[model samples]
Target: MSSSGLVQIDGLSPIRKEDRKTSKVMLLFPPEWVPTAPYLALPALTSVLREAGHTVVQRDINIEMYDHFFTMEFLIWVKGRLGMQLKPLQDKEKAGRLTEQEAAQKAVLEEAYAVDVFDLAQRSEDAKLIVRGERFYDAEKLERALNTFREAMQYISAAYYPASLVFYPMESNLGYRPGVSKEVFACLDDEQVNVYRDICNQLVLPSVSKEKPTVIGISIGTQMQLMAGLTFCKMIKESFPDIHVVVGGNVVTRLQEEWAKHERFFTEVFDAAILYEGEHALLWYIEAVNGQRPMESVPNLMYHASGAVQQSKEVYTEKTAALPLPDFEGLPLDHYFVPERIIPYLATRGCYWGRCTFCDHGQGYFDQYRGMTAQHVVEQVTALRDKYQCRHFLFSDESYPPALFKKVSQLLVDRNVGIKWTTLIRFEETLQDQAVWDLAAKAGCCTLYYGMESANERVLNLMDKHAKKSVIQNNLHQAAKAGIWNHVMAFYGFPGETRDEALETRQFVIENQPVIHSVELFYFVAYRHTPMVRNPDKFGITIHKQEEYDLPLDYYYTLNEPVGISCLDAMQLCEEFYKNDFSPWAVRVNSREHVFLYISKFGTNKLPQIYAATKDGATTAEGVSGLVTWPMAIGEGDEGKEGMSRVVSHGVG
Candidate 1:
């Protein structure tokens, strides 16, 4: 791939869409999408696909689509359409049930699921609402809405199309962090949008060539994953109609229920939708499309054919070791902005403490705490480093328990590969062990992102996130001493968060400033599949829903006592972020598991001197807010000539 993301060599199109019997797949990520990551169906899906002896392509579109002119205008428009509140599918006993919670969830489902008939009419003029998102959705209408969005974006600004990868030019300049986040796409100007649109459109239609493989596979890791998939499917359908397009990842499963309803979209854009982990599923799709295997037994597959949608048998429980280590070689290894791969490795899936009431990951015993052989992990690392010469890695594992850390501590030391890495580790003194610390530092573990959920005891219990504040603090101090960058994820605005407790969070940050490198604050949004969403009524929490999309603030909780701030105070919270150059991070601890000694700060611009100033100290919060405008929005102009001096850039990469 050229540094410009344009193939300087002639006719480097991907594998053709024919010869479906061969094991080839194209994974796609969507453009200008939201969500840090999506439909994380990859780890499992990739394994499923690979298990079937098929080639899989991982498309990192979450970062890719942002390369386009993803204007704040689009975001604001989406916000206006979806509203600021979330519809967590709560208050119902089941996901689709219509009990009180279900009723509320249903109300939202009705709205979001349905195409804005008026908008559709406005866009298409004569096109009828083929699939209504009403109680009885016509599959035809669903297709129309999707086609409409696609057509609109394609036509309005498809000319400038050169920036398919937003960071393509500035990639090497980035530090060890991941690609510019979705948030970075905000405040896009007309010039940036036109350039980005042109670049993206250019990549959309790959010129066919002999080098084009028979089939291509793309992986959707974030919302952009979906967007990328959307474009790839369309492009392939238009350019290489014979190629079978297959799609799968985590997000697909969550919305499978809705997606399953929209058959026309799949029939037109893709051949199959693999909702389950596809390590083996890709093979199934290949075999099925290529006449290699039967679909009856292909677990977790959604296919559209003969004007009907066919879903394969569902399979959940699978052995971790049985899965492949993930094929990272095919990716542009050197293209990784991080010096090292920032390799998102995981020791295992599933949290041992999978009792978080609000986490979708806790459902169906999906993420049961399971450990991989430390050797197996090291072996993968060895392979990546030897092949890609990666010097740093970032473990994307949601949790790395003490035992797993202890078990690998020595192996990493002895293996002597001398790589640096970071993982999401629980707050435990075990990390303080000299051997562990020494090995980690030597192994390239420079930072640890710890999740100290909250300072509110009641909220912790409610969320089932057990961590004592005292222990968390101690862990941070020890981690700081251990020479690790301690970025703590402190959450506020959960149930039972009193103003006093909220203030306590601030106090903790101020007091532990030296120990903690950075802090992050978050308002709780009940995950789609978590117990909080499953049984919201039992806890007296109500969630409002919106159609089309959701955001962080859209989710809110009601407690016996209103703690911290309600959703209504979301602005006040903004007031805090905008007024202070403090870079808007949070910190927390509770009675359950502690997650101190680490934190991940979102990289923003450097605010004015927050250390010496206050909202009113020789300035108003408005004056200090890096975002000069309303609601702390860091406008595009804020990012000045070389790199804005205002947006705080300090963060854990």
Candidate 2:
């Protein structure tokens, strides 16, 4: 870095002077989600191309769209849409078509419009202030600000647009389920209500026009991004027909088989769809586009040709493990949602334990497990800290390699890396090691998310988790005692799961309220391509599909054999249980912003106290599944030591 503290990448070997003269590749991450942190895929891909002597320009339109849309000026545009909805009621009242009760409700809504909700146009400066951290951290103020924001967004969604406009839990008509191209194409044609199209014109087109890149890659990681991404492709193809539009990510990988059936969709929208670990596929696809290689040589790429989808041969390479460290040089780091920029680094690809029946993770392109060496991870961390002046990281892995992270923790401790990081992990026996947990905490591990899945041992075994109820508890206890926050992810509505078993899972969470800082209870999603979906009979369920072509969509209907809990019943029960019984600190599932804010304010150790006070106000457990024996204090004390020792000594077999 220069003396100005600006990031300087001129010395990097990957960025050669001649590469700037080569074809310019623009990688874009679309908008309408949490503005915190650029998704790691773009940076990882950028590194791959730059290392191969390619000029790449990476831009995050997600943050840019947030900056443009979350202004007071935009409030006036929203109010106009809300007014259009209210105009019908006014006309009805003018024509005497409203009854007394209906008039009263109409008047109430008018009053809301006449009040400060409509005055948001004047609060534009305050909106900026609130988002800029004047009111972001304070729970009460943040709630009010978000309520106002949500009210405006919901009104816009109801009045003009057709998308779930929220900071988290995004959904849209352009759904992520496979074979939704026809439906999404209809959305693309809706110019009147399609705010996404407007966004692309306002934000995406200008940049593309300026750079004039030969290849444009869009990363769609979730169902929420599907609509925006497809619209982006459509708009780009319509305006700049020659730019090769490539779309890929985890979601595309999931939909590859079904998407191939709709060849016209690609013919109209994108040039190709790259699958799996997209680094190799994208590089080869770019090369093929540049005439450096034949189209047939490109691996893992699918495109339309001769009115049919043409697919390249599947490529296998350990390139992800050996690729240059992800380059975040061009992203707008300071504009992310969080106070500290959390760079996502991948330590492994695919799951270390890939036996979960309901999971499609580590399948297809990611079937083989690969992990970067511990020394490589250490070097990457040191380089990132020095280059970006960043101290927070979120490890982007299916499940961080347990043995790999152990070595990383030791290296970070020895080198005094001083970087706070978090990642998802399974309930493995290594977590029961007190020394391991302590070393992780010393190396700045703040939170460890465990996929508890279910509290019932039968349900867990049925899912092939290979973890017992007792082991989950012990790991949580040891992690907490070692000064790391424990986030438990509980899922219900599994095949053949009884109502009693679901309730038992809820009860287990209620009992372990002290050591557990947060819980994310989820209803089971029967993803396609998983063992459970492929062979429902093996799990004692019947999948009733309309067609027999093995195409997977997000939602499915199934008959539970011998009267197991239905998905609806499970969802309703979980909703009621969480609303009535779960601790207030335990946020609703997928509320990423709330989790970050909670940790940012209280710190990880105090999370149990924060949540425990909400329900019965107990920081210590009274017989918590034989896992935690005592309450853990922030500093090293006798109680904390005893709790750690007990957890370590009773490690689950």
Candidate 3:
């Protein structure tokens, strides 16, 4: 290995011409992620491989699956699958051996069978068109289209009964706990509830067969993608034993240690895994497979060899400036559920403010922070704009640094990039100036997502966020004043946060509704690698580990002392806040892309049509309360149009 852990076998003699030849590679992004845009990982890796003279075909299976789900042909096929499922259950019921669960599955299939598949499929197709056309701007029509999608998802769920699959939020449960290795393995082969198996058969395998790529790389970025990504790996390995299967992404990086212990994952599911930054590592691995380099020299790689799993000794980090712009060429951009293409661009690799005790996002990167210059950012933004004709961008940074934020905003304006954008940012004292916000808005900043974990200063300090209440308020006010939509995300509990402190956060958001256009409140999760979980006593919490959860990424925890809100209490508090105070944030359109597009369309933060209609037929404005929202609850005696209008809306923050 070289000093930097890059493969150093160029001087070595090649074994054979076939072994030394360049290989065709296929990169697959698995499902259960938001299908609004192409994830940056595939394109980022694809650019490197293609630049290296290898033929690369990148597939966004997540968006492809969603696109296929609402089609007439796919829905008709789902109807047949549902009938097949019903037959087995009906046979069991007739034999008087059906269990309660089986009977419930039978009922689901029966109800699904009763629906007119042809009519449902037509509506489903129309739903797809509405989201991808001018009708998306009509909130009412878009809402109905979204409802049709949910109905189609419900119909498909019957085929894979007990597996809850959703569209917008990209949540899917395959009736198996993903954290446990045994269950995860069992889920891969399960013909009943593992919906991904059918998805692989219909979508992934045929593509693999046609492309016949020598190597396949699957990116599993989130926990939700784990089951689906792994299923794709296993199925592809089974069908094409000669093809090399590799997995990588944020989730893989976080669980690298645990994955080392699971020998079957390397031997059966995937041939190798990449950790941390994957660009250089993957290129090195491909060279190794072609016999031009030794496998051990590939940095950030782990593979099964000689009856054991081994990780490369030295880890390599990417030079942010050296990497090429993400290649979005092969992805089906128009298939995404947006009227216009919205590209996701990353200028920074890791969090600059990396001290938050609750965050494990930093663990995904070997280096905590590396960012490109403001001029470089604007240059690439313009390049992407010209190449893809996409004017909306999602700056998928961990947190936009205040200095870089100001510089980039000014550069965008100076260069006249003319692209609408949104990104997550921290509330910085340096960003108190109104000119910064105005410049950002003028540079086409449509929205900003703030990780304002708590409004209480003491709670913020406990989390090591150190953001002042004054700064938070000032940031929101200025951003709003500049016509930018501010979406604030805060959690209910930290280890030592009291009930009153949690209430303080709730009250702060309620009082600042005019400035905070949207809100998301979550209960704290003790990720296994978070600073708080690592030093439990220091954070006044005791981490709980379950033996069966061998592949665990997070853990349950308890307060070390009886002085703060317990985990259960945090959950209850979040529920209470959603029930009582979520009215103002419950929007007709919940997807971030949709909201960003709306803000860009209206050219203002105040969108009355986007809000839920009040019981008195008024739009629920900021500071409004007790109004029925999109996901309104149904009362015992309520029915018909009035009841439907009273339902509250639920969506991502």
Candidate 4:
């Protein structure tokens, strides 16, 4: 080992900086993310790595897993696996020693066995064709295709009993809680319930073997992907002991401190982890591996060295303008569920308005805000548009700053980029101008998702989101008038918010239904890194922490004086709103990508065909009780509707 504690190969010799060896890299995007578009992380990191003379292959394993799940070959394999599981369970039951869990597994296996895998496989294959071709424009056929995917997921879920895997809003669970590190580690090695192990064996291992990459990086952006990402990492490490494995992304950044404490993760799972902005850090890490520099010189890195986990002394943030345009050359763009490819673009590094007490998205960045100029954004976006032959774009920024939003809108119109796009934004008084909305629409702004946490002025101010009610209403009205679909995201129970204040938010959404195209209502969560959680007493709430949940990102809480809505009250209110008042927002096509395509095709947000059909087969504009569609129906748990698409707006400012 070198003095910096990096492992060195026997035969390879260290080269000078000017003659740096080309590192072979395999970048994997793990499962449980939306399969509509390629995530920006892989491409973003790939561009930087390739720019530094590295050979990089980026794989969207999430989309690939979904694609493989719908194939006849995979479905038949799942049937065999299920049968093998059922055989052992049957023997145990016949011997009169079956446990309740085993019996339940047997039941699931039997039901799945009865599912005629041949017929389902054919339908599933047909579903793939429907989504990729012009047939996707037909709403009925599209809905059937989506249902076919869900059915395939159910069939696959049976092989891993107790694991509920779904297609679009990726709410898969492996019967193991992710917040508990013990459960996470146990789930990694679980043969029966961890579907990702099979996924890693079938999909990931083959690619790694063929490429023989010296370094592999897995991006775990959300909690949903943590298990799968780690599964791939652990499997890759075990199978190819020589290849270096590293994990990064927003979720990894949030859990860096927790990971430092878990030496096993560093020693057994991955060789290292890149935190915060990973472009420069990963490049330097690859250099360290190649022996061009010491490992200790790589910024934002945490690695096991000399019997301990050592973090780099320095931190680095990307200069937004200096970065190259994201390269999507190797991704399977045609295989996404949508017919036309929607490229994800990021114009900013972090949120400009980073004062929301309930938000922890800012934790993902070291330097809170670093953005590209309007001209730079337009240049890169247009370049990507022409290169990919894709017209639809998803601006994947935490929140587009108002000045940049206005300037980019003007530039796109003046430059005639002609690409339909959508992004997450905060309702601001600066965006109240009708002319600005018109310009944005003319520049191909198909949709705008707003994080309108609450319409009650007091609650909004308390959340540190001082958006005025009038300004929010005006922004919605103007955006709607400009033919842009407005998706309003609000929640109940922010610390001391009273029942009437929560109702005021509901009333605002109901009263503004004409302008509010769609809605996602949720209950409050005191994320571990949020301002409220960091200083709970100041917010008049007490956070409850349990020792078992060592890797928790959020916590359960209670109001100190009970003067406001309790956690249960917020959840119940959310459930009641969806039960009684979600009809207007409930659409036949619930995916944001699907809605974006519809709006782009029809040139308007008033998509009557996309709304939920009445019993008589006609679409209705009036509110109807108990009429819920694919994802608008809130679940019974705290993981209420996170939105239609995870890629579009999960952690938006």
Candidate 5:
């Protein structure tokens, strides 16, 4: 074994021509651009490999693809395309084929013409510089730049392809929405919608080739990334036929049975699939791949054997305290879309509650909740802060373990890590304590995203969320009292939920608007592996059509019979309710990027004040207490349209 404890082996005396020999390996995060903030999976795996004394290279191709696509040169190309493809608003006959979204892009194109192309280009450049921290943050300038960036993406998608690439997440038509094998393969085979293939080929493949790794590991964390992950696997197998390919992530962990039954998928795309947490799995698998042992010995692995699929004993569970600080060896931290870099760390894995019926977050091997010691957490942060010269951080745990977080919060003060962070947590009774909230705030807790799924007690019970509506209200009150921004994630349309219950959720948001700074409302999605899906009858839901399109495995169900409201009805209800005021909508929080700018100018406690001044133009020191303004989206009709505004119920100082 090597000094770092990684197993090492010698090649055969003469190394057979067929036995490709190299210890180098590359870990990849495939694209489907979401937040430019680093995802935690690759870094976690990288830490494992490096601690085991292996040569590992990690890359975030998702952010890289965005950086490559959003360039001045590409903007020039988009400008030229817009000149030809966009029709005047008066050309009704020619514009008839345009969808609502496309027509909106046409309006953006027309607006672009009002300003000189060169001037628009200058603004675009300034936005890039501002995003990269080259210019000062002006609220108006930031708003204008974001609008210009959005329009640029809209123009490209509308004129050239069928995709949505914007400031937030990137969406493409080739998503693995149809979880079945056939639909996924069809989308992968279609080059028109699969623009990521070209992106991988032009930008990623060259870099991978240069690394010359013997094995390629791809993380497929969400259904959105399935196609891109498979595309990379297919490309690598075709180009470097001798290279070994491995796939794993949250999505892979859930679809083990689906992959096993459809063995041909793995045969054609990857060599093996890591079942659960990958730290130990990758370490053992790499040793086996190095010819030190046989593949059958690797735990929690699914691979092909003699024309049939085979699985190894499932026995790898990571001890969080044992994990080394993640090594971001080859990742381009500076290239992420934001000016200030935010490092992602998972302080724990699996949900502590582990029983939300609408969630599959704790199914199968993921049910066991675990967390690192508070000391370890602080040490990891300090090391990362020193190494990256970045003090911004985010905990990517399923739900940041509350008890662990409280301990770490105290440690942060003693150690003085000097970092600002955000994390997701449940609205449990433990956090209602002001002492806990104060510890978090003193440690620089900027935001806490609570799973305030619903305000209706019945809906909460049906979903097995186990959180009482009143308790949630108190938790938000305490969090806000600590001066931390409280963001609530809500959802309606759970099985058997009535319209009255849905309305109650909205009313709850309005009543607690003082405590809750932002709200993200989503309709319920019945995941296939959830307890509710397993016993749909209990929830009075019937699975009518499991497969909606040729997409990855997403659920489609209807209440067995209407219980006061249907899914469609619930959706419309929420939409109409929030139509006039969007402040409660999470869209206004701006935490993804602008929140950092806000804090830099105004102290953490004064975020609401800056928000009021910028968003509402309030003259008083207290700022506006009722309505907030949003820059009108292109083609949104009028300047002060109700649909284009967000309203905050309380003033912040």
Candidate 6:
């Protein structure tokens, strides 16, 4: 019977047909958020569900959908559809060079982000300049991000969530995305809608026969989709009224604090909405609906049944330490777009240093921090390697707990998990020790994402990111010495940022070129749930009155600082840096404008944007550093957003 029926997928293997004979459940990944891939989300949900003894199935609509979109024939058609925008990418070698006609258009697109018009730090007062007209958008670069992403998808092959994909589908937050191009919009949208409809049909009507699911648990993952959640619930109800539809995820919790009382506002949609984590709430509700319980008293569940919506009490305030690891046994690990199975994990919840003004890291009403024991960490990886037979894992932490990491990493080395992993890490107390590094690398952690924001101290003081440049630099250096591939995340356009500081940032990149993977940029955007959302008026940051959307929305307003520049001015600076102004430029002195060239490459899908990791006189290397920059754009007449953390290089220029 070794290959006969199904297998139980606990921490290592999920519950497959071999293990369960009665029930079936499917975890649906709505499209658009490539960043929040299904690999990260599925494990968390499934682990908890399995803990409750339920059989689970995962349907990654994004991958299945993309397979239907980007084909070998389609890339060329998309490039042609994008026309001028894609001309630069056809030949990677000629990325930066432009024809006069193309140059003129590029100039216009580059200039669109040239003026810091929001008046942060009074730059607009000193210089009356505002980027306008054709200069308002970087159509070509935007096109590059899209087409490259379309092309990159051929390479990345990630499992994505459709909720946001159905809505904003583009990675608009960071430098990682294909810039938003208007030309690709029409064709992509048509394809996206077509894909969504197709998948929904597949869900309702699989080609072969299967039992109707006992319950449908729809996740409202992002807060931006409150209305979409309503509409989605209504649609599901209309389609699958025979089955119970239970709603969950962080989105519902946030809504409860604001609009759960407005049940009349969302009638025929959600049968029950869990405000907090879905573990216990889901188990009780499922059984109650199964007629096993006479009357349901499920904690943290909301329902608009019997004509009125009823609210429930909070479940667990603190996260449990002995968390069940994601069961990946029957799940499609190979389906993800990675070199190998990068099994992503979570070590903790809520950032340790949570005082940053603009960030909502510690905003979950129950934002209590809980990390797993080192023993548990080792056990899970050991089990995964024993069962799934994989070597790579990725940690999906906002900022993974350093202590937990220290112990867990050490334990992995001792236990010989025989796996390698990567994580999103922070500076400060975490990066100070050497044991953590030695243990981490040996334990299979080969990469670290360090958010090093700025090289300037004044900026650091303003941002309140206690991460000192010296400490980060040394840690990044040491990590490299230990043979860890490091990624440093940085940013531009703060409240008090000067072209001089930007130059210094580029200089830092040049100096520290050897011990990094690549420099990344994050435009400061005010996130919801933080203190900034509490009083944007006090901060001069006009808050965005959020509107209902089918996807994620930037609700917090972001402009420039108080003294010299406007938000638009800072935005202009960002545009320039994004276009021509390059970081890690000092290393490749000859290729100083490679960033601009890289932009063109993306536009043309010709050359790859090169990152400088190590420097050799005239050349720069490639990799990541530990640079993390918080935003300063709140709004004009604003004090600016949180200047959290931005790490720069020490000696390149």
Best by TM-score: 4
Alpha carbon lDDT of each predicted model: 0.45, 0.65, 0.81, 0.83, 0.66, 0.47
The predicted structure with the larger lDDT, 5 or 6, is 5
Among the numbered candidates, top lDDT falls to 4
How much does candidate 6 score in TM-score? 0.66
- Model 2: per-residue Cα lDDT over 36-118, one tens digit each: 66677788888878877778999888887766666666656666655765787789899989877557646644654564544
Model 4, 1-653: lDDT tens digits are: 33334332211233455887898999999998777888888898999889878999999999999999999999999999988989989999999999998888899899999999999999999999998889988877887888888889998999988889988666788989999999999999999889999999999999999999989999887788899999999999999999999998878888888998899999889999988778878888898898778898787789999999988756677778988999999999999989999998888876788787887777777666788999999999999999999999998777789999999999999998899999888898898889999999999999988888888999888988899999999999999999999988878888889999999999999999989988888788888878888899899999999999999878888889968999899889998887778777777575788889989998998877677677987544344211123223211111112222253542210
Ranking by lDDT: 4, 3, 5, 2, 6, 1
For each candidate in turn, the TM-score is 0.63, 0.83, 0.92, 0.93, 0.82, 0.66
Which residue runs of candidate 6 sit more than 4 Å off their true CA positions?
1-24, 35-38, 68-169, 172-195, 203-209, 220-235, 257-268, 292-296, 317-319, 433-436, 493-507, 537-540, 544-553, 556-561, 583-653
Could you give candidate 3's per-residue lDDT for residues 21-120 as a string of tens digits? Answer: 6789999998876667778888889888887778899999999998999999998998898888789889888899999988888888899999999999
In order of TM-score, best first, we have 4, 3, 2, 5, 6, 1
lDDT of 5 by residue, 480-579 (tens): 8888877666766777888889889888988887787765565666666677778899889886554334233346778887675776776676566555
Judging by TM-score, tell me the better candidate of 3 and 4. Answer: 4
lDDT at residue 357 of model 3 (Cα atoms): 80
lDDT of 3: 0.81
Better of 4 and 6 by lDDT: 4
Which candidate would rank higher by TM-score, 3 or 6? Answer: 3
On residues 323-421, what C-alpha lDDT tens digit does candidate 1 reach at each position? 665555444443321212334465566555555565553222222467688888888777766765655555556556777676665677788866666
Model 6 C-alpha lDDT per residue in residues 33-55, reported as the tens digit of each score: 33212434555666766776777
Off by over 4 Å in 1: 1-21, 29-200, 207-216, 316-318, 339-341, 362-367, 429-439, 546-564, 581-653
lDDT of 3 at 37: 75
